[model samples]
Target: MLLITNVTAVTVDSQRRIITDAAIAVKGGRIADIGKAADLAPRHPDAELLEGHGMLALPGLIDAHAHSDQALLRGAADDLSWRPYLQEVIWPLLSRRTQEDAQISLRLCMLEMIKSGTTCFVDSIVPSHYDFDALAQAVQEMGMRGVLAKYVLPDALFGRGESPVDTGGFSGEDESLADAERGIGVWHGAAGGRLQVWLGPLVPREEPPASASPGFYRRVSRLAARHGTGITVHFAGTIDDPPFFQREFGMLPAEFARRYDLLGPNVLLINGTWFSEEEIPILAETDTRLVHSPSANMKMGEGFAKVPQMRNAGVTVALGCDAAANNNCHDMIREMKAASLLHNVVMMDPTTLTAEDALEMATIEGARAIGRRDQLGSLEVGKQADMILVDLKQPHTMPIHDPIANLVYAAHGGDVDTVIVAGQVLMQGRQVLVADEAAILEEAQERGLALLKRAGIEVAPAWPME
Candidate 1:
């Protein structure tokens, strides 16, 4: 049992309460109680005490969309348009990754995520010939929670789905489905309930007979429902996405998803940047979750999602750092700040997305995205003890007028001094507890170069060498 006392607790609960000089008690990997430090100290006298002066306790951030496999490609494919970048860079890089490369990439990915105060993430594993056991082991060893899935591209109505123009051919469609099934069977409920396996289908937006069929999605949805897991797919992300789907399928992406029974409480639609206003109601009515990756979208020239509109329409919107290749980092604090500022600037209304709104997206709403609302998300009693303590005494965060506002707008991921997930402290005082950080960093640097070499890609620095 652990008891953290003398902290400013930002309880993102039903009332969005903030309690100063408070304490939280943990027992059996769950939040046991929360109240004033003075009051709780006497009750749990024997609990291991953590001094939390000058700290702000809140629910650990949840990243609803991420691609851990792309963590090694940061800065290698920047400054390119989305489609070309995907076709020319990401796909090719993925093709050359080995099982050892993936394990190293995921370790680095988990390191960054844990350092950034992220307790849980939903990763869309890029399609490749790799080892799931190694990936799952890395995640488990790091003590991070994740929703892991293999990326599935269904066979198009015309024939097999089209691969990247430069890449030779798409792999077997039956094999892709089999891999997804095998992933679920092997990894679902593994890691002592710290990890879950989901189905991730790339949205069918390209022209048809090259587009994914309704039957494929229906089967995916059914499998997800039967497993009591979830399905995550990219939908209406680029400006051309909606139109392409509309022209090919005679409907918008959301409507098509709805018709195929893919829009439901168990579905998370990533990057709804191009969702038509008409589709908002469908999403709200179906209780579907939308994940917004502000930095990635802006970097890729994909327009910002209509988050304010979606919120007003009663839709649950969450936040994510899409991938390191696009966003260059998996810092949820930076993602939250980007999300808060992007909407306000796009709407030219400072009141559009408040700090509280952004924090909710990173925390509770994100839990809803991966279907873990009941167990994770908030700092309430009986919830899993997944939380972080941000040091407010830092220079940039000093004179904190409002802790929640400062957390969203001012604090950096490095401000997180301690992270407790499921009653276990994974990181304390800026140091990860589970893995050898220096070794992981060294391995990642070596493997990253080997990966680029294998893929026949060379990235030259733009500036002069020293």
Candidate 2:
């Protein structure tokens, strides 16, 4: 058992309370009690004490959308439009990655997330993972909670799904489904429910189909239902998605998903950058979830998503960093600031999305995205003791104004001094405890650059260097 005291707790609960001089007690991997430090100290007199004299405790941030592939290729494909960014840079770089390289990349991303106060994430794996054993092992070993989505491709259309240069992956349609099902059967509730397997289908026509029957879509939905899991797909990622869907399917993306039984409380839609104004309510009515990756959109020139409108319509919109290749960094703190400012400017309303709103997207709403709202995403008793302590004494994070506002607007990922998940301290005082940071960093740096080199890509500054 552990007790955290003398801290300010940003409890993103029903009342959105911020308790000063708060104390959070942990036992049996769950939050046991929460109250004023003075009141709780006597109750847990024998518990291991974690003092937070000048820190703020917030619910662990959740990355609703992420990619392990991009972590290895970050900064290797910068300053390119979406077209060349995909065709010329990303896909090619992905092809060069090895399975060993993948483990390193996964660790790299996990390390970054843990160091930054993210305890959970939903990763839309590219190409898809053939064997989830290694990935599952990595997650369990590192103690990070993740829903790893295997990219399920229609084998009839993409005979052999695009894969890494060295790692074997997705095959025929039936085989791919079987592989994914097998994964869920074996790993879905693995690691003491710290891991889950989700099915991912790329954006419609995003693969080489040019045309697709609803059969595959319905099959995946059924598969997910059978497994008691969820499906995540990119909805209207680009500006052309709406028109393409209309011309090809005679309906918009949300309507199409709804008809195919893909829009529901269990389904997660990424991007939603081009969901028509009419479709926003459809998303709300269906209780479908959408994740906003503002930095990724800005980097790829994908245009702004109507997040404020979606929120107003009662749609559950979460936040993510997407891929490091697109966003250059996976820190959700910076992503929150970017989201708040971006939407405000685009909507021409300074009050469009508040700092608190961005914080919720990364916290409580984020838990809602993964359908774990009750178990995680808030500092409440009986919830998983997943939390982070951000040092407010830092020079950059000073002023002692509204804690929520400062957290969303000012704190850097580096200012997160400690991270606790499942009542276990994974990182403390800027040092990781679950993995070998130095070895992982060194291996990933070399392996990542080698993958980029294998793809024949060169990364350098704009100006000449001697």
Candidate 3:
């Protein structure tokens, strides 16, 4: 049993309540009790106590969409638009990764995520030579909740129209499906139920030949449904995606998905920036979720998603930092701030999106995006104890008139002082406890250089370097 007392609890509950001088009791990986600090101290006299003076306790942040394999490629694709970056940099670099390289990258990603107060993330491993079992083991050892998926793409579409320029290493549909099944067999429900496996297919923008057919989607969807799992796909992020669908299939991406029975509560659509006004209702009607990567979308010059419209239409919108290579970091707090400001600027209405809205997207709505709302997300009684303590004593956080506003606008990921998941403390006072930080950083630096050299790719510095 663990008890945290003397803190301001920002319980993103039904009423969005905030309790001053509060206490939370955790036992058996669940929140047992929460009340005034003075009242709960005597009740849990024997429990291990943690003093949380000048701290704000809130639900741990969640990243609904991420690419763990891109950790090593940070800063390598700067200033390039989405299509060019995919064709010129990312796909070529992905072809050169080995199992060891991938393990190193995963470690770095997990390390960054933990230090940034992210207790849960939904990640897709790009198709490469990495060992899925090894990646799952690393995630388990780190003691963080994760939704892992194998990147499934049809071989016929690989290296073809609208895809990357170089896609020599991708697997065919049959092979990719087999690999996804193997991943499900090995990692789903592993780590004492902290890890889940999902099927991730790349929704091709261009019309695939009739020989390719809809059989690929039908097979994967049936398998996913049978296993009681979900499917995530990239949709309408680029200008090409929606236009391609309209020109080739005579409908929008959402309609195309609806034609194949792919839109539902279990489906998560990533980066729906190009979704037309008409598609918003379809997503709301089908109960499909959307994950907005504000930083990545803006960095790639892709137009912003109609987040305000989507949220108003009854669609759940969540936040994500897409990948280290694209966004250059995985800071959910930064993403939250970006999300709040981006839509406001795009709509030319300062009142379009609020600080509370951004925070909810990173918390409860993010849980719904990954289908874990009942167990994770909010800091509620009988819920899993996944939360973080943000130090409010920092200079940037001074004069805090509103806690949610301060959190979403002023604070950085470094403001997180403690992180707990499943009633276990993974980080305290900004120090990680589950892994060797020094060694992991050293190994990542060493492996990253070797990977760049092996891939024969050089990233020119924007400024002068020795």
Candidate 4:
């Protein structure tokens, strides 16, 4: 048992209340209690105590929509548009990635995420069989909580302007269910259920006739429901996405999902950037959760998500960093900033999104995204003790008028001093406890460059060092 005391705890509850001079007790990886430091100290006298003076404890940030495997190509594909970059560069590179590459990327992303104050994430890796073992091992080694799902497509999904068939010249339909079952069996409930298993279907609409039957998605949805796991899919990103679904399926993305019984308790829609006002009601009426990536969406010229509108419509909104290849960084701080600004600007109301709302998207709402709200979202008593200690003494964060506002607007990843996940410290004083940062960085750079070269792509010349 561990007792973390003497910190200002930002509970991030509905009232956006902050408890000063407070402490949280952790037992068996769950937050045992939280209250005023003086009041709670006597209750857990024998527990391992962690003093949190000069720090502000917040619920560990969550990344709802990230491609953990893209960590290897973090800065490599920046300054490019979405389509050409993913089609010409990223997709080709993904085809050649080995299990070794996946493991390295997973580790690299996990380390970066922890440093950025993200305790948990939902990764969308390329559709491949090797990721099952690679990511399972990588998550265990890294000590991060996440839902690792294989990126599945009925056919070759992204290299061409139009979707391509699998390499075998036949459809890759069976691959989806196979990978789903394989991932759930091995990784679900691992790490005492801190790590979740999920299914990610790459295609937003129905599969090709040669690839799968209409019942294929039904079976996939049913399987996810049966196992009580979450399903994440990139439903709509641009103006074209909804129309594309409409043309093929004769229904909007949300309508289509509902018609096929896909809208349920365990489904998350990534990047609902193009959702129309009409569709908002349907989404809110269903159990589907929405994961919004403002940085990536804006970078791709996708307009800001209707977050304020969605929230007003009673929709659950979660934040994601998306792929580093697109956003170019796995920084939840930057995402929070963008989310706050975008909503305020779009709504023409500065108070449209409070700092507390932005923080919830990164923490509690994100946990709700992957259906882990019961355990991993907040810093409340009886919740999992996944939290971060932010250095409030930093220059930018000093003179803190409002702790929540300072956190959303000023504090960056560098301000994160300690990160605790499930009662275990994964990082302290910016030092990762589970892996060597130098080794991981070196391996990712070399492997990523090698893969980029093999795909016949050239990069910008390195800058001269002083």
Name the candidate that leads on TM-score.
2
Error of 1 at 102 (Å): 0.9
Per-residue CA lDDT of model 4 for 1-466, tens digit only, reads 8888889999876566689999989998888898898889898889888888759999999998889777777666766665677767777777777778878888888888999899888886545545476677778778888888755554434334445323322245575567668778877889877777887775563333333234666777877888888788777766767877777778787787788766766888887778888888988889678889999887777676788889889888999999888897888988999899988888889999988889888988888777877877777778888999999788888898898889999988888989999888999878898899999999988899888888787777487656
Candidate 1 structure quality by residue, lDDT tens digits, 1-466 = 7999989999899998899999999999899999899899999999999888759999999999999988899988999888778877988888777778888888899899999899999986545455777788788888899888767656653244444521213354566777778878888988779989988876676733365578888888888887788889888888888788777788888888899988999889889888888889999999999999999988988787789999999999999999999998999998999999999999999999999899999999998888888989999999999999999798888888988888888988989989988999999988899999999999999999988998898998889778
Taking every candidate in turn, the Cα RMSD to the unseen true structure, in Å, is 2.1, 1.9, 2.2, 2.9
Clashing pairs in 3: none
- Per-prediction TM-score, please? 0.96, 0.97, 0.95, 0.93
Q: Would you list the C-alpha lDDT of every candidate in the order shown? A: 0.86, 0.86, 0.86, 0.79
Tens digits of per-residue lDDT for model 3 on 1-466?
8999889998888898999999999999999999899999999999999889869999999999899888999988889987778767887787777889889898899899899889999885455347778888989999999988777766666444554432325446677788888888888899878999998876656633322235677777887888888888888878878877787778888898888776888888898999999999999999999999999998888888999999999999999999999998999999999999999998899888999999999999999998989988898999999999999788899888898899989998989999999998999999999999999999999888888888788977778989
Q: List, residue by residue over 159-255, the lDDT tens digit for candidate 2.
A: 4444322223444578778878888899898888999999986557634554355778899999999889988887888887788789888999888
Q: Candidates ranked by TM-score, best first?
A: 2, 1, 3, 4
Q: Candidate 1 has what TM-score? A: 0.96
What value of lDDT does candidate 2 attain over all alpha carbons? Answer: 0.86
In candidate 2, clashing pairs total 1
CA shift at 460, candidate 3, in angstroms?
Answer: 3.5
